[model samples]
Target: MSTKFPEIQGGGSLILAWQIKGKEVLVVAAGRIVNLLNADAKVTVVCPRNGLNEEVAYRVNNGQVKHVDRVFLPVDLEPEKKVAMVLTAIDDPDASTRIWKYCKQMKVPANIADVPSECDFYFGSVHRDGPLQIMVSTNGNGPRLAAAIRRQIGQMLPEGTGDSVKRVGQLRRKLRKVASGKTSRDISKRMAWMSEVCDKWSTDDFNDMDDEDMDKLVRYYESGEVPSFEEIRLGSRDHVVWEFDGTFGWM
Candidate 1:
């Protein structure tokens, strides 16, 4: 048996969690699990055969998710490979269970399928646009509910939202680097400034072109010195929080 992985409490539920401010993530799963996760992790999907088709891999379009056509071996599995999390979807209960057992014994956070009792957390379905990503999670109990929520979200969000969001985030990241903290006024002012820009973004004929422009936005955000987990109203209307640490870097 593996060691214990710490569980995190969120929304009044205990789930498998990790706080990786800046850590490499390794995903050990097949198909959808590997394709879903993205961001800061060094993701590598462990599979026994060529489970993922090329077309499916192209959809995610991320450089991560390396493929190793090999079965899991206790001797070869590096439980301590600077990995933040592991997800197993081996299609076989016994195989997935075995992998989960090993990760547990090794003290790494992990999850398995068809065994909710043993899972700490299950991945959620998400919709992404520029800087906004809406997730529909059913706590592994109701896929039907998740799908229903996804439909509602699809109706709520307008098209081209993801592209707009990415532009904003790139800009914020740039601003953060040169911005100052400890000043409430700066933060407020910057937030307001961002709001203004975003509001007129579609009409101003302004769009992010290169790395420099994105960095400029990040630098501007830094001037506010905004902290992690920022909550801002969308289009100067509805409240939306954006923390999005690269925690779920790899699903």
Candidate 2:
């Protein structure tokens, strides 16, 4: 056996989290507006009222999203509006193709829903928990499979992982304030120290941390001293233990 995996081909999509907050996003239909709304995207749906799904209709009526109340137009991508992205889910194939072409001509990114060939980007199956988001992408091959994998991964993750991440983020902010200086080396050292702390601590350990515990960590950072995980971990809780059978099963 060669014991080496063969090189894969044809999927070279670059995955990224598109920042759309406060930016205009034109959605051609109602199939996938909920995720946009969740991301705080300034969405404008270009579809008749009868075309909207129940949730979308409620959102439009509540003024949560702007509604055009008609079919999509080329003018929707007018230069002055500076549309950040377009997502078209309309049933008309010709109209979808036209919208995709217009987006390309206008140099705007677009996702022609369920039409991967026309999409500039494909939405991944995302596992969201507070400040933490884990996205699984299959390069437009299998969205349902990606979602299934996401669910499996989600189950494997320890509970309170999101809270741990949030706490770590807060600690990083506080550490930055404490270690603030003009030196690039200082920033590098702070980042390295944080990395070490994360590697040493488990999710449960982070969940057990309080303001006092975090303050102690900051003090250690300020003093240019690194504390062992045992030294900083609270005594109130027992350390989390993991056991594995060394076998993986598909859902």
Mind giving the per-residue lDDT tens digits that candidate 1 earns over 119-175? 766666766553465667777768788888888997876566666666667666655
Clashing pairs in 2: none
The regions of model 1 sitting more than 4 angstroms off are 1-29, 33-37, 50-64, 76-80, 170-179, 182-251
For all predicted structures, in order, the TM-scores are 0.57, 0.86
Q: In model 2, where is the ten-residue run with the lowest total lDDT? A: 234-243
Candidate 2, 1-251: lDDT as tens digits: 56489866665778788787889999888856778888888999999889999899999999999999889888899999989999988889998999999999999999998888999888899999888899999887788999999999999999999999999998999898888875899888998889988887889888988888888778888666666555766322355454577686668
Worst 10 residues of 1 by lDDT: 228-237
Displacement of residue 43 (Cα, Å) in model 2 is 0.8
Top TM-score prediction, candidate number: 2
Top-scoring candidate (lDDT): 2
